[model samples]
Target: MHNHGAVGLPLGFTLLRLILLGAVTVVAGWALVRPFVPAASGLLTRRVVTGFAGIGGVVVLLIAEATWMPSLAAVALIGLLAVPPALRGARPVLGKLVVAAAVLVTAAAGAWFSGPPSSFAYITLMAAFVGVSWLALCPPTAMVRVVGAALGVTLLAGLGQVTIAGQLTTPATGDPLLTRVALGPSPVDVLVVPHMPGWNIVHTTDTPLSVGNAPNALVPALPRDGTTGRWALVWLPEGRGELWLDRAGTRTTVPVDPGKVAWTGPDVRGPEGPDYASAVLAAKLTGKRGDLPWPALTDADAEALRGQVAAIGGPFTVLTDDSRRAAEAAEVVREEAARRGYAVTPGTSEVLVLGGTPPSGARHHLAPWLVPPDLTTPEARRYARTLSAAFPGAAPSRSGLAAWAG
Candidate 1:
């Protein structure tokens, strides 16, 4: 059975398809027009070809399909495709003049549009004129064959040019994340923002951060040193700085009250998730690794801190709230140390306890009964007792815990 749940079109695939279809439309036009022109009457042929092309365009528009405009343009090209074949035997001199005039007019219009490579509509018009003029002006000179070849070449060039132009005109989904530049007294401080390469697949929401016009550029600027997979700048809070994370899920704006937060910037910045995602993916593909761990919470370096804790042994204090998870873990460690013959103090607010001094040349191991400064006397003492009970050999005291620290 076909699983509908698993069926989906990837964004990259969809985009590539659109591009290919656009190319196809331009390429196919010449072929469609070539065949019908040789057998049809001149006026009837032109009218029929142009009429069909116009109808095809209208149909594409009416359908409002994904590639409607491209489809229409392709259809319209078919008429131009026929110009050389149909004009081969016509009044050579007149056809040449007409074709030349058409070409000149199209060139003027193309200049007005400033088309890339050359403007699409104007290029197509010129291609048609060139083919027709060649056929009409040089009848004895393999006119049909020569103009037909020119038509094919011209259409191919026009197709390629238009395809590129379409690409340029279309909003880009994958581009490098632009580093936001902040003017500094000495030199511009440009913060490298992490761009998640494949993030555009999921997080499609475009906020001001995406547009680079966000008022709070900092919210989008995170100190990305490269370690963790690239981060996408999702939010930029002016003055407050920016927030970034890997783009994999949906994100909602934290709606702070209008008065609680201020928006100040050159312009309202829109979301930049797609661009950032693309960059990160590209970086990952290239095997580029960065130096810094991201977001700071799940830092790989945090593991190093664990070693420092292990070396300090029993005397190192742990202050915890009522949850007691930290305190409980400490008791387990202290018990393990005692079995190994290390002298350590384990303290909570209720009791200040001391174990025998460590072995000669041993690191200090003292557990002090410590609680947050603001805890009530009784609550502090209760916590101390909890740890003291866990450490039967040591004396737990509230003040000892406080004094143990430098």
Candidate 2:
């Protein structure tokens, strides 16, 4: 028997989330309506009211994404609409001010208990704060108003955090298991077996895995067989002290023999040397048969890559920069691979970096170690400094770059 583990929110939490979201939505709706409430001889004419209503409706939609800019805009618009009625003949009473402050404090405490504020909840709370402020500035209201305000404040406390926590805590359904494949070479294959579906196994390494670098390092896991799922294999490079695999947040070590696989091919060099070797090995693992091409030999190189794709017998991507030469090189490889009867697309993965712009994208099979471009230019260095000051500890690195792409 296999345990897939808990996969989604608990039934009670799911109900609670729905209820809280619904209450917040109700408060937002009230706030939206409160601004349009017609007053005798007020600044708002029918046409003006309709126009503001239409605009506010759109603002509400934008606040669903709850990005900072849109959220601020929504708050400003709500305040503008609420000001006239809230201010008319309203006295600055100490009791109302105290109540408003208390409501806000209670709402904030609720939100804190729910967890860290997500954008959606934060924005919702902001809008609610505006509404509560408007209420405080207005004349004393009825029992119904008191009840509504209390409920709104209560809902605000739990609204954003519960949803954020639920999303963060949800576990991936599929688990990965590794098995060693001791075939004829120094870089042997290790099969990655997925216990469930929807597993796009991308991150693997030959060293101890960390949250930072696991996504960037190359693992010996080459897909030797054309098949996926149960038949998938990872080619481990020879003489690596250890092999590490990471999926989602889980990490594991796969045991391997350190024996070297003899290489009879022409010597390849440069930063792209590992890329070339990995591409060829990947192709061979997928049962592709072709003559090895020398990297220095352009025609032979294209043919060799073509053979690799032909062996793999599936979709492939060519990672290139914005430069003309890089684009042309990518085109050459794409055309060559396509000629071998497989679809080859432009953009990262099965990567061959010619020059300019670091290789990135989901399908990249090799770790691309890169020097920060900020090291070379004054303007770039200044920008990097500014970014570091703003984000702190987020200075650019290969792993950070890959995670950024993701």
Candidate 3:
């Protein structure tokens, strides 16, 4: 999914370009080959070369799944070349069937393996061969004319249905689902800010920089205008509202209301005291505010937050994916928690089983890396065996064990 250097083209546009280019090339090639076919009827060179070219084109199409070779121009060229073999005089019976079967099979195999884009591109090639074969094999009579007319009508109907279906299924421009996670070609410069106490908000580029992902995550370049040190207050999942409040001397919690505007006090003791400024931020930033009103919190809310932090004892642990960092973070959290009368044990095991579910009031968010069970490797397997022997059934999950040690 993370194709670092992947290039993309709209599926319909790519197919159109392929067909237009192929038509031009095919027309030009036919003009050159028409006169020579009569004079060189017995030569094997033309047959051999055409067969090789057709086979090579099929191979190229299959490989295009992982590579961008035989660009649109090449596809047109090969499709154009196929027209001649298809038009070569009337065949007895078996020879015609063999050619038709081979071409169909080759085209199908190439299309199936070439990813959706390439598969669609080769449809034109298939159509060209089928049409040319029918024209060459049948006599210029009423039956052939009737069959062609029927096929044309059927194709037009099918095309009309497909077009209508496409329009209906397509989302409008502003629809959220149609938009990708972030805008533009460049990756968003995410600033994750987890609600870690005392730590000056850790910043990382890892995506989904919302709650449970980053520590005090901020929007990229929000402080360009130094006059106002503006930081967007974000609401975490489970109706949790957070703000970065640092006043000149007296910093106090902004009363966030789920039904009204969130109140934040200005730095000075003068005018901006109780007349707080508030607005409805993004839902992801404000949890689910649509059903509720704003001025989002009350004094009771501040008391509730205090109680939650008190129950947690203090300080959230931050564990990075790196073993060295996790180990270091674990040591810090363990020491700090123990000092605050909460028992703490830290280990680099594949699994962690806390004695109870995280306390409701506790702001106890584990570092991102610690959320998932670690995998066990040879070194890990040895460690897990020792740990499990000491504490039975304390081993990591089976999948994690396999991924870690395998």
Candidate 4:
């Protein structure tokens, strides 16, 4: 599955988060500056400082409850707003209280959101360290000169815990966990001729199957033996093209000859065989020969086609002749389109006709190939029978029905 990136937060929440972050940064800068400035400077009165501290405390609580990572824009804004206050300084008893209260509030918030950091003993130790440091900084202590040294160790420890937790929990940038492609026999054989070195073909005993990152380029499971652990059962276009295998965010490309890869059936050989009727059907459905399209109507292809039609945002119609195969193919197309919110209205200007003459004013057409009488191979006959069973109606031609085996 593809990672399309994170969804944006709502505008009101984002604005509120920014406001809270700004308040926290300002209050933090003031507290950092408070240790050096003199009282005679009169930069801030105790009354005003206490009021701002209260506001900052409320904002911190809100931020803790929300628990959102600050965006780059918010960080930049905070940095710019912090410069002036950080440069200025003051030494006030109330300033120490403000900083200590902020720290305690933050710790309380962390405990409420995340479970308590480590254990009860660790928590008690941290609290003791904080209390000792606060006592060293307060006016009653002779250790005021050594307050910075006391807090520095505790600050470093907290930073270490944050850094380690972030590293352990977060995946490296641009590196995502990939779902490994299952190894074993599949409906269509995919020949891997590595264009680069350092690649080895491996096998697994996993059941069912996984399409990995190339869901649209292959069919699911169909019984085929003798290819269990050697060859990967994937389908590519019939020619020399690049085949990519992605594992652990690294992609390995290999050149392949798709003509050598065989489909599952008695009469159906590889794409090079004459009776490879599946390829013919895929070509008709996708309007592309021997490229990307598999020899079947895969779910990926259906969804892709639906997305394309939905993107157009216009009305269209699906038409088919009296032939059973043509009607079956048309129904498949109509159903897929409908699933993507594309309605099939009658007499729409855009019409997709299968094995039938386009009605008047029709703009789009997908005519099927008429099977020649001499082209009566076992594979072709099998396709005909499958079509007849899908839609039982008056047959179209004497030679055969439209090919719709997939």
Candidate 5:
């Protein structure tokens, strides 16, 4: 994950601050509320709003997947709020005492058994703390006010976990997995969407950019026939190391140690189908590819790139997510690749899998945006920094997200 923003503030520290602020707020609220509960008798009293509050709380608890403790606490608070005022007042002192003790026990149990996953432990624990604060704040007469806020905040904790779980399954906008692509927030990480005649910048605000989801992607306008263009999927399996991208349809085999670029053949399907096409295009790279790495570029190299792409011939699209400028630069790469004898087909993405570190003979390292994951150097980092400054985005906020869109 990328850290820091356009102004160079550490992203990680920002998240930590948010967590701390939530904790402080809950603690402060609890301290303020606890003093008003004069006696245990107050716990047994009910107010006018209890019925509606109890019904809502019970419904939410039943429908939600909150762990036992938050659920238990929410239910108890609702019940306390809903009971008839006289009936609650008539309850024996010992009975109220037992219920209070049970709640305390529930709190302890929640602390022990229902903690957040380690990856997001700090945020999860803060939610629990906030719920405990609510426990203290739920005065009998204002049951709806306090309990409602508490349950709402605590439910966010569960949502956080769900978001984390969804990370693996969510499909990026461009479906990088299919095209053998990578993504990050910075310009160095984002591919420029070659510009067309009437292109305009899409996302003007600086929300930390995920290249895969960035609105500026080289999305070819679908043809009138609606058929996906011909795609050349190729992968060079790492020496003696192989991974499988697909196990369905015609591509069920996994290579243990692939020796050369394995072509899945020319595919002509939209993003909707299974990985049968993508798997053919996939490569299992242990190290790097090609003899010489291209120098990473900073800022827009539009004119220079155009000169370079002049050799590659007409009507080509860039392999990028940037909706604004990917088309502009694709010709540079297209021409060069064609001049170099790599296949250049119309309406087809020409992909090459380059892995492993460059040999000592390599002189020019490619731009950070072009380099595959296995090959990143000091020069690449420098280029990335420069590119980021040129196209800055706001720090990302991934506190809550959901799954599934392919």
Candidate 6:
């Protein structure tokens, strides 16, 4: 079973966490109880300190997670220890509750204000805070008990269950209470041609591809330097071909008998091995290989984009509905246009791009490439109409004006 985010913690982070934890203990111990002499008196009074500690724990953890500072979260837990003693000097219960409520209010102030963090980080930090605060309370023995309990709970949480003899003591089940998800896979996309069968694998690189004039860029098939001979695969849906193998810089083409094939170079295998799943194959030869040409843009699409660019520089009055997001997007359009020799500048024709929200309410899922605001002015209406003409799918809005933002 693949437990999500079960990846081991990096050693550097682990060491840093230990140091932070030690600091929390020291701070909490020193700030709370100054040892010897007037020992912690009035157990009831000490209990009130717990309430203040709770308030500090919640607020500090929230702030730490929002900022991705785990060390700060640890410091916050230690600071909470001090908070209890400070509040204990007064009517602690009422004060603690007031502070806790204030913390909740602060958290609800939305992304613009409260800068939300990963829910898991927030939860973990809060748990650590609670444990440290508990340890800071009562006698010195409380540290041992609280720390042990905290470690056990944290370990079990990381493992996703309490197990006995490799079997779960408590049945594993999804909980509605746990809203935080673990770290997830990176964002990526690839095209898979359906019905085109055989061995399928995709390779990609982040290196920017150098493109040139025309609608496509041609890249020569130069095999990267690394010797382990290269193999060529040849066949189509109507399967009729063979496999060719090369070593070092020599070229050798051997006709494959149906499935029977053999290769020995980087892979040490005796004789021919059967390659049953290969629709089409080509190998990159040393200095002798085909050039790869990719369509940068279709002629029609290029013309349409060019036209759009030309429109931007002249009679277009671009109105960014959101100065924060749409303002940048509008600028991108202008830059791309300028790069293609369209050179758009601000003008009288009103073109408004509504960002942050679309008619569908989801700014991400359902919006098109571009979203124009409701056509109120004549210039906006004209711009929308032009877009509709340019893009057939760009049907006008209720007021019969078309605008798009992708």
Candidate with the greatest lDDT versus the true structure: 2
Q: How many clashing residue pairs appear in each of the predictions shown?
A: 49, 11, 29, 3, 33, 15
What TM-score against the true fold does each predicted structure earn? 0.30, 0.24, 0.28, 0.25, 0.28, 0.22
lDDT of each: 0.33, 0.37, 0.32, 0.35, 0.30, 0.31
TM-score of 1: 0.30
What tens-digit string does per-residue lDDT give for candidate 6 at 21-132? Answer: 4434443543344333245435564454354345535453433334423444346445544465543332324344335334433443322232222334344434444443
RMSD of each: 19.6, 20.8, 21.8, 22.1, 18.0, 25.7
Candidate 6 — which residues are off by over 4 angstroms? 1-12, 19-65, 68-82, 85-95, 108-117, 127-406
Which ten contiguous residues of candidate 3 have the minimum total lDDT?
A: 172-181
Among all candidates shown, the one with the greatest TM-score: 1
lDDT of 5 by residue, 42-142 (tens): 43223222222333333333222234346556556545534432243323233443464466445545644543222133223333333432343344345
In model 5, the runs with Cα more than 4 Å from the true position are 1-45, 48-64, 67-94, 103-111, 115-357, 365-368, 371-406
How big is the positional error of residue 60 in model 2, measured in Å on the Cα after superposition? 19
* Model 3 alpha-carbon drift over 4 Å, by segment: 1-17, 20-128, 133-140, 150-310, 314-332, 338-341, 345-406
Candidate 3, residue 222: the lDDT equals 29
Decreasing lDDT order of the candidates? 2, 4, 1, 3, 6, 5
The CA lDDT at 182 in model 3 is 23
User: Candidate 6: deviation at residue 12, Å?
Assistant: 6.5
lDDT tens digits, residue span 308-341, model 2: 5555566666555444334555666577666766
Candidate 1 overall lDDT versus native: 0.33
**Runs with alpha carbons beyond 4 Å of true place in candidate 1:** 1-38, 41-48, 51-145, 161-279, 282-296, 299-301, 306-406
lDDT of 6 at 92: 21
Give the lowest summed-lDDT range of ten residues in model 4. Answer: 170-179
